[model samples]
Target: MAPNRWLRPEVYPLFAATGVAVGICGLSLFRHITINPEVRVNKENRAAGILENFAEGEKYKEHFLRKFVRNKSPEIMPSVNGFFTDPSRN
Candidate 1:
């Protein structure tokens, strides 16, 4: 409960003084309370963000498919000769 909210002008200074004291003590104990002022997203870079996500997805897809193919039949998977002809895995 805020004392000033319920108390009058003469009583307000007392409350304010006490508040500053308590705040200083609390801040001393937990001094790491700082703002995380991160930059907001830019609307103009949306297309670039989309492209980055798409490219990342493409990378994962290729890696996954390649690994699957290599695992199914390493000898015929294409890591040696074909290196890119495993039909059933991808």
Candidate 2:
């Protein structure tokens, strides 16, 4: 009797990677279904529905990364931006 070929130490990483990929895809799908207003709202009250949907959307809140950078300078490196923008520094 031969052991299962799929059950091997070398193939474990592949299984892990596959699981992670599937999990990410599942989460993305779930997020799209739940959070996407366009998909949630229908034609009956599209005008009001969209507005309401957007209002609900706002309640869910923005991503942490966006909130972190909101109202922040667009510059990636402030020193470099200052060096180029400051006439006195030239």
Candidate 3:
């Protein structure tokens, strides 16, 4: 389309207004969808449940970890010495 022949000057502001209105509506929908407190609590509860079950399980906390500490003295992997540690050391 040629700029002076195909494009109408009056339609430019209409297009800009429509674009802005769509952007504002999208942002409003996104805010309502993301900042829901109930959904946040639900997500947090799921994460907390997983961590609690895995790290604080009675079998792991009381038995497996203790045996692992006794068997692997420093409990440090040669490749990841700084990254991993047995809770017994602390």
The candidate maximizing lDDT is 2
Q: Quickly count the clashes in candidate 2.
A: 0
Give per-residue CA lDDT, model 1, range 1-90, as digits (tens): 686567777887898999999998987555333311121255564435434355545554465457767657546434645645556546
lDDT for each candidate structure: 0.56, 0.77, 0.59
Is candidate 1 or 2 superior in TM-score? 2
Error of 3 at 34 (Å): 0.6
In candidate 2, what are the lDDT values of residues 9-88, reduced to their tens digit?
A: 99999999999999999998997877766565455755554354566667556766779899999988999889999999
Give residue 50's lDDT in candidate 2 (0 to 100): 33
Which residue ranges in model 1 land beyond 4 Å of their true spot?
1-6, 32-90
Q: For model 1, name the residue pairs that clash.
A: 78-83
Model 3 regions lying over 4 Å from their true place: 1-6, 38-90
| TM-score, cand. 3 vs. native | 0.35
- Could you tell which candidate, 2 or 3, scores higher by lDDT? 2
Model 2 lDDT at residue 31 = 77
- Total residue pair clashes for candidate 3: 0
Q: How close is candidate 1 to the true structure, as a TM-score?
A: 0.28
